[model samples]
Target chain A: MNPIAQYPFEISVEKVLKSSMVADPLTLLDCSPLTDGAAAIILAREDIAKKYTDTPVYLTGSGQASDTLALHDRSSLTGVLAAKIASEKAYKMAGVTAKDIPVAEVHDCFSIAELMAIEDIGFVSKGEGGKFVQDGQTKIGGKVAVNTSGGLKACGHPVGATGIKQAAEIVIQLRGDAGKRQVDGAEIGLTHNVGGSGATCVVNIFRR
Target chain B: MHKTSVPGVWRRFKNRYQIVGTQCETCKTNFYPPRELCPKCRRGGKISEKKFAGLGKIVTYTRVHAAPAGYEKQVPYAVAIVQLEEGPMLTTQIVDYNTDELKIGQSVRATFRKMYEDGDEGIIHYGTKFTPIRES
Candidate 1:
């Protein structure tokens, strides 16, 4: 999508359910669309960052991990092993736990993936993500605001730009520039980016 | 025409004809699609060809209602992850079962069948597929 997108229609659960089925467990609504978009961030050292802006969001921690290429080689289908490993590394570096995060942007390449990623990244105990979402815990005012940008589902996934787009969402949330979608008074935020069905995963934490 | 090299298919005839994989003697590990060396044991383990009897149970499955590219005619086919008796799992299409009837832990056995036709006049590719093992 372009820098500013104007959605012409409304999205609801009923419309999604009525959408065409691409696969038995996954529907056309569940999959992200291939969008034409691009995102860029200017990184600066502390001294240079201070020269540029007074409200520079700090990149506190980052972690990356990989899993077996073959899905059959994986131990479980319900969780992403790489996401857990990567997020743990990031949390350890940031000196914070999942409870400290008030806002997050996770890879929602598919709806089921969002459920699995929240569990893998330790946002909620394993198997609780489904229930957590069902109770409206991921909304803007809910327990921990997730995917405030409507995630990849509605925001559009431009493959390579998806990761940076996620980070940009967190940056906006942490800097209090996200407008109505902002998680109120969010000081720390996190973004999770995945590649090719959990073969690769990356997590980054930001603070302002 | 979706072209698949004859050499590529020819090389994997063993795996396509039957469930032939590799096993490491040191750690008693099995691999499907085979491996050049043991991932865990590496140079320390003895590797050999292992022929499996193809009996297994379904771990998970999906019916693909949307086929990609040249496979548009094969929509709504059943695909599943089957855990073989030898411990390794394989991703294969499930045959001879209703798409809605596929279930987790359902007993299954491998069967050889035509995988795809390259094009209208292209060669027919054959490979192993799993089917539900019906009880008498």
Candidate 2:
């Protein structure tokens, strides 16, 4: 399937191409579209979870962290520190590490964001994210299946709804309801969301 | 079309116009958007005003095709994270040169420019932007 056709909104391919920097080479295809949408999920206590559904997807752990609002204030530009910190906390609370996650829905507002996220979450060594993806480690049936739901790159990014959308994708994967994009025997899944550059990050772990 | 109060503009005038930042007298760390208290020193740090040299090199950059509401006219502009000589990074637009000239580690110098103009009756916003310094 043509990836561009999968986008719900029309992408301004020309504008993206024209804006490309000589050194960085970012075409419009490398960026996520501005979308208008929303997503919501129901939360239930463990006791009442079964009342809602028999195969209740449990939220094992969640973590959130913040940094300076402006991108310039951050100490490092290569990775989102907040993401690294938040994911570490989430992994600790879930009693699992990055290596244990079989599937993940990560923020890909920009293609670079997804690359940096994998590294920040410790799925790959720092500065090796680009090479890791190129090596097919992030592909389904590879080391880790990432963005099986098309991610923000193919999926639309409604600013306020992005975080919830990421969680919903992970839940669908955990429930084995993500037909065609399901990761076989996926017992653990993770979702990562970031706000404005590297200012805020939230990481959640879910288990079936 | 955006409405910015006089005081809001006034508060940021120094930093926006002159690149005035803050330094932690205790830890010797410099901050770009002048902070009242240093994060490293917390309540124990003594903060002092420091004027930046307004010169730096580009660390990373992006060509923004989609801009926020007010910056629509400036679409396809180049914005970069420049590491200032004083050891603080700042986000500013790269102007007065072709986008092809931009590269990581290229030297740049800050220049004051009009960021945006409000509605006809609104005040014009001015801030610092960067330009590549040509080598002899």
Candidate 3:
């Protein structure tokens, strides 16, 4: 079956079929598709960036970390420790905290993954992420706009392209180029990308 | 199909069959899919082989309907993060139960099973999978 045609949010007869194809509690809708795509952005020093674009999005800080290749080797299954470490380093280097960022592009390969990313990156306290999302805190114009690009969940995760895609989304938001989905007055944004289960993670902070 | 050589299979026999892992002497940390060095202690920590009891519980799980390249036959299978009794956690398939029957914190124990056959000419790989521990 062409899974892309069966996105749960879209109205289609295939949606019902796709929903039933997976075991209960998690359907195909919860997972990201293996898509083919690419994304790229030219980054430069502040002086060079200012010369290139009037509204240059500054790459304030970047951090990366790795854990065990296998998911089970990690201490906590609920959150990605690598993500936590990476984001913390990014935040420190950027001289900002999660609350300081009003918008973010998070890795949401699976629905559950988004929840874990929010918590792991310190947007919400551990175990409170589900509630935070449920309360509409992650929606555009909420406490923090997350996945303004529709995320990997709807944006289509092209493995190698995911990190670049995330960065592009954040840069677009910080540059005030995102059309209707743009978060109002978004000055600072963050992008998170994970490889494999949670083995590798990269976090980048961008500011207008 | 994925290919596995005789030596590759032989090297992991102790871990796949007996669940042997490693423990760091300096920090007393344990590892599954055993590592040669302690990430925390690096070169300073001494490592020693340790055998696990093969008993643990599910920390979290997902019913993977989308099978990867060579695992199409195992579609809709339950995979979980199992925390072993000693300390280390490992990702392994949970067998002999339906999705509804599994839950976080449910007790489980390792059982030998066929992971997959590489190909017609390749080795039939074996590994430990977890199953719900039946209450007596």
- lDDT of every model, 2 decimals: 0.88, 0.86, 0.85
Best by DockQ: 1
Docking class of 2: acceptable
List candidate 3 stretches off by more than 4 Å: A1-24, B1-12, B24-30, B40-46, B98-101
lDDT of 1 by residue, A8-75 (tens): 24578887888888888788988988789888877899899999999998999899999987788898
By descending DockQ, how would the candidates be arranged? Answer: 1, 3, 2
Q: Judging by lDDT against the true structure, name the best candidate.
A: 1
- Regions more than 4 Å wrong, model 2: A1-24, B1-12, B98-101
DockQ (Cα-based) per candidate? 0.82, 0.34, 0.43
Q: What tens-digit string does per-residue lDDT give for candidate 2 at A1-208? A: 1132247444565766676542346656777767887788788998898887888888998999998888777767789999999999999999999999999989988878999999999999999999999999998889999988778877778889888888888788888887767889999999999997779999999999
TM-score of each: 0.94, 0.85, 0.83
True contacts kept of each: 0.95, 0.33, 0.52
TM-score of candidate 1 against the unseen true structure: 0.94
Candidate 1 per-residue C-alpha lDDT over B56-121 given as tens digits, one digit per residue, 9 for 90 to 100: 999999989989876678887888899999988999999999644599999999998988888888
Model 1 sits at a Cα RMSD from the real structure of: 3.4
